[model samples]
Target: MRLLIPYINAMIKLRLETLRLSVSGRITGTVYINLSKVFFPEETWNDFPLTIFNWWSHSFLNGNEGDYRFMDGPFYFKIIKKNGLYFLEGFFDRKLIVSTELDIDEFQCSLIHNIEILLNTIKKNKWDIDANLDIELLNENLCKLKKNI
Candidate 1:
């Protein structure tokens, strides 16, 4: 039974990371962000969907004072899907902070697929990139993952 639990966990982990080769040529970044309001389809295990309301990027550059500084990225989004049609689900700070349903449009589906690839690449090793801390990105990803019905 203990071995089964470990196997189940490993399977779930793999499922969360595996890229859907069937849906290629789109998606990017460290996390999945679909513009649609629905993350999971009707046949999904959960109710809430996935989405990304906004995203911020921080990059290192020379500041006006002759020092390196970071700048925030843009924050814009669209509704990709209607409801109930996504694979991945998440929580904030390890708790069910917010949840939303997503609907993946053509563009969003492409983006989510690419993001899965990016996430897999990042998991190969660690880097100094603050890809997870940008407010826009956090807000967007959080909004997509945890929005109320």
Candidate 2:
């Protein structure tokens, strides 16, 4: 999948810092966001049709900030928008984890790319997505964001 609008060369990337064994169709790995200012981040997980990434796609794609808290039990992050940029102030289990910022459009592109890569990873691993609601929503968001791009 590709973005409908050409990306504006943002200095942000989402890489699989580490990958582990698959369990129940979920690819467990570190969804590392390589950006300019994010520090002490701990964004890893099961690539199941879960809430984390889907919620992220929903929030940023619609130009809205998100507050995510689900993973390692208390994984949390809040995306704040300011001056045409987005800031993330987050924590894992009550300990501050992610604190960072990036351009708004770039942030949306990053989010769209995350879903695209995760979906690719899912397909590569031969995980089933016949009825996964999270995958469905993610795909919808991906397409929607791409079209407006």
Candidate 3:
């Protein structure tokens, strides 16, 4: 299956492209989503690897609404579920940037794919990346999420 989620009038196409790890263990990567060119960091951000996303995935699975701020900046993403549909919205300084709908299974796949990207990067590099990565917990959560998908 392709990574691109169908971008209809009100649908979101989001994905993460993991670049590399810094000497300090922060993830340097890009978030690929609709209108992401202007908002996300050019190459990567000096941010925790997969930590926010792991939490976001877990919350998305268990809750009806949740919000996440990006790179400690004004950019934020909020997810809300109603009538069996998921609404994904992005905001900057409380001003709405974009809003779109995501499919249930599509979002699950997005989480699984993102987790795999981070986990595989660590595995392939064979770096002592766990000091800040918390890999064991990520792997555990990944397994549980995979079973659901």
Candidate 4:
């Protein structure tokens, strides 16, 4: 039994390392909100920008992590990664509106695509340069448009 325990521990460690690698990135993505539920019922859904320069910087990413909260704007959300699956939870004034597992790769792709669209729109508007535009601020605004900052 003792010998089997060691093997089990090693396997668990390896699995954890792989899971960590899967999510190891800048952690940029937009969290969509059903504003109709939070605000006017006639309104549709909206996206909220979210970004973590280095998600690993958070203590939860270290080991046996707990829920990570998002406390910005009128709404709130939480992110949780368990056994390699990433879950996002959305709330409005402490009431849960949505909870679902997210595919990180897909989310990243969507984020990048939205960023490209933003860039193109800027170029189309001839606001790419000489407008004294703040790139960082533009990025933030672009994120708020549906991607992450």
Which numbered prediction scores highest in TM-score against the true structure? Answer: 3
| Models, CA RMSD each | 17.6, 7.6, 5.8, 15.7
In terms of TM-score, how similar is model 4 to the real structure? 0.42
Ranking by lDDT: 3, 2, 4, 1
Ten contiguous residues with the weakest lDDT in model 1 = 1-10
Number of the predicted model whose lDDT against the real structure is largest: 3
Segments of candidate 4 deviating more than 4 angstroms = 1-73, 128-149
Model 4, residue 120: C-alpha shift (Å):
1.4
The candidate with the higher lDDT, 1 or 4, is 4
Candidate 2 — which residues are off by over 4 angstroms? 1-14, 17-21, 35-40, 43-50, 83-85, 92-98, 129-131
lDDT of 2 by residue, 1-149 (tens): 21121222233234554544354545455553444433223334433324567766676665567665444456556667778656666566666644555456666676777777777877686666444777778788889988876
**Model 1 agreement with the true structure over 47-137: per-residue lDDT tens digits:** 1011121221111011101111111122112222224332222333233322333232333334334434345444554423434543335
Model 1 misplacement above 4 A: 1-104, 135-149
Clashing residue pairs, candidate 3? none
